[model samples]
Target chain A: MPTSRMLRRATPWLMLAPSLLVLVPFFVLPIAIMFRNSLARDNPATGMLMPEITVANYARILGDWFYAQIFLNSLAASFGVALLTLLIGYPFAYYLARWAGRRWLPVLMWVVYMPILVSVITRVFGWIVITADSGILNGLLLGAGILREPVRILFDISGMTIGMVHRYLPLMILPLANSIAKIDPRVLAASTSLGASGRDTFLRVVLPLSLPGVVAGFQLVTAVVLSDYVLPTLMGSTRFRILAPAVFDEAIGSVRWALAASLAMVMLAIVAVTMVALNLAMRRLAPWARGL
Target chain B: MAVGEAGLDLEIAGISKRFGSVRALQDCSLTVRRGEHMALLGPSGCGKSTLLNIIAGLDDPDAGELRIRGAPVADVPPNRRNIGVVFQSYALFPHLTLRENVAYGLKVRREPPRVAEERATEMIALLKLDGLEHRYPNELSGGQQQRAAIARALAIRPVIVLLDEALSALDKNLREEMQIELSLLLRRLGVTTILVTHDQREAFTIGDRIALMHAGRIVQVGTTEEVYGHPASSFVLDFLGSASALPGRVEPGSPPIASTAFGLGFELTAAHRAGLAGPVRLYLRAEDVTLSREPTAVHRASPARVELSTFLGALKRQVIELGGHQVLVDAAAGHHGPRFAQGDAVYLSFRPESCFVLPEGE
Candidate 1:
């Protein structure tokens, strides 16, 4: 082959070399190291990692019902939070994209996006303040004579779910709003003019078209909620053992690095399988975004 | 008051709309008899579209009454108004197949599944869109998409159909072909229809009556011949086609005489002369005037110079400068007259009755 033709062929790979350089060292190497570490054995007395090649860590995690239950609980919480966020976010997104006039849309966007700007710790503290026994919610219910006593909210699943929804709502809404906005207003008009009511128009046209964004937002929110550490620690009861908190406990308190690595690998596997499944669902449901 | 008549389909009365402070429509009123095709024709931003949107119930009028059949429906929502619309962009549901898109209205109305499918199939065949029903809108050609849009609108058997510049998106040749095909289809269906268009030629091809609009008001409404041949105003004449106007003074007499500053004179028709005085504007269609190399003593011929000659297919458009006034004359391509160059001297003449006289102020 001519040198010029060889150079031309080399150009594309050369352009891609910088991204590959970062990926190999930062992502691929770390994952490989983690997988190797997960197979090592820990000293029985000190719980320190030792050089070995075994599936003991995986056996410990899979054999123990406590660890399996923690994993299931985390997956369930993330799935629940994703659904709740979507239910709350979809209507607001629709309003912002379609009905809110120019005058109020900017103001509404600021409100929707404001929580994201605040640190998650600070927002979680805000949730604590509001849901605490002597908080404003309890005070309001007591003052309004709607309750006999203050209701327990903080340090419970409800508090954790609420915090997760608050943190991930804007994530769900932004994508949904964008997809809804791409729909030509004329299509809505054409539907209405063809004797389809507003409800029918939305069910038949708007919802199906906006499914790609919904699925994308669901996957993103679910992944974030699944692996979240700080939120579960702050808002959840100590009795509740989600995967992230358990991994932290095994590594720092128990000094079981192998167990922690194995649990981390399991979490990674769950997220990977979920993302793949969600991607397949998006393609099947909204094939319009085929390339993406 | 007589809206209950069986022949009436749509009757709009004293309709007005304002977008913020700009008056988008004002007292726009028109009536369409059953099976009539009314074309709302105007230039862009002329409020023809605003009026159509109001009639379609997609937009509300500040003050007006709209009646479909015999009953008022101003307060009704768009979907409840029982009207079908074909938009300029077609606005086909991108996610649905052609069959699904056509069946959408029926499905929305909660027609049984079997009935909706049957109606969609019928409409597809009606539009000659067979064998392409399963394809998505993006997969179809422009003309096929257009036909699909029409089929979708007609599937519900709407009381009336509204086409909003529906054929404007196609190429010129295809647009003309669709225009004829659409006219024949509408005739066969005998559905009351209103077509909003900016192109006068399209209006002429499709509309039973052309309603010329200007600045948020309907200026003239009549048959194509009535509106084109005897325009009601200077705007109407100027909008409909190319015509040269000569500002002249009218001398009152049993039959008034009009003479221009360029020494051209003509006798005005009786209707044009009634209760009129002072200056007048006389318009002559380009095709109405003939050009010759030599002056004919028998005709009222005026001297001119050929400024430019443009070959327009079978007709040669010769721009004649007559006494510092420019007028276009369309001569036959095979005329036996000597071929005229850029600066050739010529004489222009036309039948005097063909000239239309309007008030000078207009």
Candidate 2:
């Protein structure tokens, strides 16, 4: 019985052992090695990494205006994408959670995630075709007289944003819908009966109650967009610089492993700080959402 | 306006609603006097809740006129109707503390912060939730949460209060306690309140007048005693409480006689017969029928065999066979009377005035 009791406790960890085994060596070990490499120096003549503990790489990136501008631009883009997805996804999430018929909800949800089912590269190519200067969007806009001429969207930040929003919208919507669905419909009715207008009820009750989901979706989109490489690389022109591509250039194009590792560490630090700050803000702004 | 319309606080006239092919409410009409407590009593799905929703302006009726405080509110939205509703689930905002929940309506109305705080505090105290104001709804017990919800509803001081099966979620003891507390509080506040419930005892406890509903219609509306004693139909008799029904026919006479199918006959007053002349079902409340070991001349006694006797704490309930029909009898237990066993022979009798001779197939 003693042995069996111990076995019962150990069974969970034993089951988790496979994933841990893979993660520790292939994921955590690489991150640890990367952190070590980030603190090292590159040999000037040999073009090879030297095992040295130094902050020179971090110092160089932070001191240089060009590198600092890339970091700021990446942050701004990530924030913008996160906000755009949330603004566009909220009403759809509200409809799905509160108004959609039970029979159609699954079908609607599948439609929302349909774009994700296709390969990202394929989706990027699809976006390229749709967002070309004389693409369908431009044609429709021109035909409707909304635009006097075909606007430039290809190889621009707007095109990159469109592709990214299309790719990441479902991530935002899933959590928003989940939290909104957990809200009791009767609570809304109670609000109405208590002399709160529809707008007031939505702003004072529904929005506050769904803050957890908003925080979750925002954090997810922010982190993913900050490190997103494919969408920007495929959609953006060569002059458009961001941390993800800069890290890539350092690691593969120039073979500057130390600089690449340092850039990746900075990106990691930004993501960690953003997640922590958002979590703290959620706790402060909507404390009742804690544990929910 | 009619003669009595001036004193009315709320009036629902000819309200009807249909969901697809199913009629939820049909030409329902009721009027509540100012400072009156009316209980909408019925079995589940009897259109009581639908009527309540229409009154609260939460749902629209197909054909109806609703007047609150002598003003037509057909075009008014629920928020502007100035009605307070306590939902069955309580529906207190889980994100808000008890104090904030109570003050939400005031905040919506843009009342001064100090006044809102004062009123919320007063309501919290009135509902005995003073110390627990800082706790969220999920942190409170069911009874406490229900009190908080009531406090929140009452904080706005609306023209009328609607309670939709509000106490159905509480345990029996807590429900009974809250029933007394809520009724007393509503009486003190003098608010025209409507309580919708399926529990007969709850209706009797909280309602000054009971509007008994059946099949999407208000079958009978009267005082608690009147509705219980003089049910308009067999459905009302069956729904209010347990009863023993005997199929019979009404025999015409100066005072009509009710004759059962098995040759058993009993004299009935004209008032008890209620104009049912042909086939009828005589319903007798279980407590109205009494059992005795020996025959007595105080009332008409029928000889019967006790089929089942159950000692239910304060009362001894026995099922007796009379004229090939089972009749339930309840006698005071532990009294100076002979107790009957399962097969004991006994005499059953009940006052003719207490029996309801309703028309058959009603």
Candidate 3:
């Protein structure tokens, strides 16, 4: 083959080399090391990694109902947060994209980005203050005589969901708004002029067109919620135990590195499986987008 | 042969619309008889589209009343108004196939599935989109997408059809072809229609009656020939076609005589000089002005030099400088006379009846 043709073919890979350089050392290598550590046994007395390779951690996790429950709980929490955020984010995104023009867009965007800018730990603490039994929410209700007593909200699955949605709502709204804003205004006018009501147009045209963004937002928020540590730690109680918090408790609190590594590996597997499932579903949902 | 013999079809009375400080439409009143094709012709931002949008219920007029078949439609929503529109972009749904897109309106209106399917099939066949019914919009070419859009618009059996520069997006050759096809289709359907276009040729091609709009007001509304041959104002004349204005004055008589700046005189009919007095501007179409190697006795020939000659296939357009005034004239390329070149002195001739004079300030 000609040198020019070979160089031309190699150009794309050369362009991708910089990204790979950053990803390999910082991301890929760390994950590989973590996976290796997960398969190795730890010295009980020395608090050091042993050379002996074993599948004891995996067996323990699979044989036990508690670990299985934790994985299931994590999936449930993430899925719930994704669904709830979509329901709330869709109308807001529509307003930003279709109604609000240059006038209020910047201000509205700042409002959406404000929560994400704050640290996740700070946001979870804020949720705790708001949802706690003796918090302002209960206080307000009690003062108004709407509730007989303080209702349970903090340190539960509901509290975790609220925190997750709050931290990741911007993720959902931005993509959805971007997708919707790109749609030609003529399409909307045509729909109206074709004897379709506003509701019908939105459902049949806007919703289907924005589904790619929906899938993108869902995947991002779900992945974040699945691997979340600070949110589950502060906003959730022992009654609502999840995978991320269990991994943290084993690693730092109990000084059990092997168990922590194994748990992290389990989380990695679950996230990978979920991502693959979501991709398949997205392909089916938005065939026109063609892997967008 | 009275129009609207069944009843008055669509009537818009004193419709006025404003965008911020810009007045888009100002007391624009128009009446469309059943099966009449009216074209709102204007330049961009001349309120032609604003009027169409108001009539289609896509927009609300600040001050006016809209009545369809003698019933007020102010409170009726766009969907409930039963008006169909073909947009400039065609705006076909990307995800839906041609058949589904055509059937969308009927489905939304809750028509029975079988009935909707039959109507969609008939419309698809009518628009000659037979085998392409299963293809998505992205899979179709520009012309096919346009036909699908038209099919979708007409499927609902709307009370009125509004075409917003519908053929403007297509290429020139295809646009002309579609124009002829659309004109014949509209005539066959005999549905009351209003088309908005900035292209004068397009307006002349499709419109039975033409309404020339300027600066948020309807300047003139008449039959195509009436607007073209006897424009109500200088603005209408200029918008409708290329014309050179000759500053002239009306001389009173049994049949009045008009003296123009070209050192020529024209005999005008009494009806043509009814409300005119003193100074007037005579508008002459490019084709009406003829060139001669020798002076003719019918109309006084003005000596001019050709500044520019543009060969446009069959018709050659020339810019001739007559003394201090410049006038445009169109001559056939295959004419028997000697071909005039740049800087060539020539005599210009045109009949008085070809002139459309507008009074000062009109």
Candidate 4:
């Protein structure tokens, strides 16, 4: 028989326990294992794994210039792509949300988001044709007497950057559009009535207030670019490597699970820390939007 | 000297807006004197908000002129209009601190940060924002948000302050308190203010002059006393204060008087002669009728029978029948006067000045 006192206290935990049980193994266990393995190193002669932990995985990545270069390369590619996406995507989303047609919203939505359904390889293929030396973009420019020769538009950081933006553009656009849509048309009026010119209102209130969405987009684009593999694999060459593919190469192809696990843990930590920073920046800029 | 920096003279001439076939406003016009508080009182969808927006330059009227002081504002945009509007919803920047919200317009004016800070601090002090300057709109209660909104609007020191149902969001008690405080603030500042509200009490309490609008037109505009006591039309009388409508006609005489079944006879006073006519409606305030014991041949006294009396805390409301028509009367509480009960004969009298008559064509 369950006492009333026991039932009162025990019921909440009983209800919550199942969810925690499911989450720990699926989500938390993998992370914990990856973190633990990142520290472990085996002695080759003993042919036995030494559970003895060391800062070796971190030190190895930090110490080697080759690995350090890859990490910086990853930062440059992700940051570059995310910046371009924000610059281009923000206005596009704002225009569509603030001024688009009542009936054409669905049509516009389809146009903007249809790429989400297409395969990454297929999308990258289309970009290759468009950007290739003899392909549509070059042909158009050459026909117009703009370029004497086809530009180097493939197998480089630029091509990968373009591919990354194409893939992550939607992620930036949706959050941005949502925030812009939430602005009361009245605030714009209030802004102007306060002696802010059209440009000033947009600059001071609309743009600044929308910074949360901008930060969110930036974090998402960076995080997505960081995690991505296919865009780089297809559009980029081996000369420029990112942290994700490097780790993947060691873990699966080179059959070094310990090193890969350590890298994964590092990647996760980087994401968490960067997200916290972005969140802080977002709060600082659009502290009012949190109230909404 | 009557006008302040922005010059409170507001002239909205022939302003009109139409959506599809529905005309939200058609040639609406109004004017406010410098430093006077005016209320645009109306029912919902009467284009009161549309008029406020026109004044704010949020919506340009299709065929009208908006002039602040004597300057035409034909091409002026909302931000450039230099008017401050506090919305019904408070429209506070939720992300901004109370002080930041107040400083928005000052910053827009390119005021130095220190000056803006000083002005914002002054407004915060004026509005009694005190230690709550750091609180966000969501953190404050409804009344506090309204004060912050007031502070923000007034901090700009625009010529005309527009209040679009600013107190509608607050609870009844808080709304009344804010209304009094806002009225006092407007007076102390001597800034021309236009308030839009559906609540008549708010309109009467704050407005020196009131305009009652209905169906996108100004039904009447005058001093609250003029609009309330001497309603120009039947609508104005019925709209502002509660009126007991009784159908009647004027008896043939040099000094015309109304003969209705509701009462024995009602003579038109000097103020109520506008409706001296053959056939018309008589609007009598419930409180105008006085009940007295038994039958008495007195000034404007007519014998009547008592029907019902109700006690309403500090006042007693009674219904006495005069010539088969029921007349309502209110008096001091706990009055057992006339030893009144159901079906007792009595005398009811009303000063000729208490009733108003509207012309028949209306």
Which prediction has the highest lDDT against the true structure? 2
Candidate 4 at A205: error in angstroms? 1.6
Candidate 2: lDDT over CA atoms? 0.89
Angstrom error at residue B36, model 2 = 0.4
Candidate 3 chain B has its poorest 10 consecutive residues by lDDT at B1-10
Tell me how far candidate 4 lies from the true structure as C-alpha RMSD in angstroms. 4.1
**For each candidate, what is chain B's TM-score?**
0.95, 0.95, 0.93, 0.88
Candidate 3 per-residue lDDT over residues A131-240, each given as its tens digit: 99999899999999999999988887777778888888998999899989878888887787777788999898999988878888888888988988888888887988
Off by over 4 Å in 3: A1-18, A52-56, A143-149, A254-259, B1-5, B248-278, B297-302
Q: Taking the tens digit of each residue's C-alpha lDDT, what string does model 1 give over B122-154?
A: 999999999999888888999999999999999
In candidate 3, list every pair of residues with a backbone clash.
none
TM-score of 2: 0.94
lDDT of 4 by residue, A71-124 (tens): 788878878988999999988888877888698777877877988999998999
lDDT of 4 by residue, B30-70 (tens): 88899989999998899999899888887777897778887
Each model's lDDT: 0.88, 0.89, 0.86, 0.81
Order the candidate numbers by lDDT, best to worst.
2, 1, 3, 4
DockQ of each: 0.64, 0.80, 0.62, 0.53
lDDT (10s digit) by residue, model 3, range B1-362: 12332556888789999999999999988888989999999999999988988888888899988888888889998888888899888988877889999999999898999999999999999999999988888888999999999999999998898999999999999999998899999999998889999988888889999999999999889999999877878788788778988787887776788876665577786447475668988777899988876765433556678999999999899998875777899988887767888998777777767878788767
Candidate 2: where is the Cα deviation over 4 Å?
Answer: A44-47, A134-151, B1-4, B261-264, B295-303, B321-325
- The sequence of per-residue lDDT tens digits that candidate 2 reaches over residues B132-151 is 98888888999999999898
lDDT of 2 by residue, A199-277 (tens): 9999988999989999999999999998999988989766668879889988888888998999999999999999999
Interface RMSD for model 3 amounts to 1.9
CAPRI category for model 3: medium
Worst 10 contiguous positions by lDDT, candidate 2 chain B:
B294-303
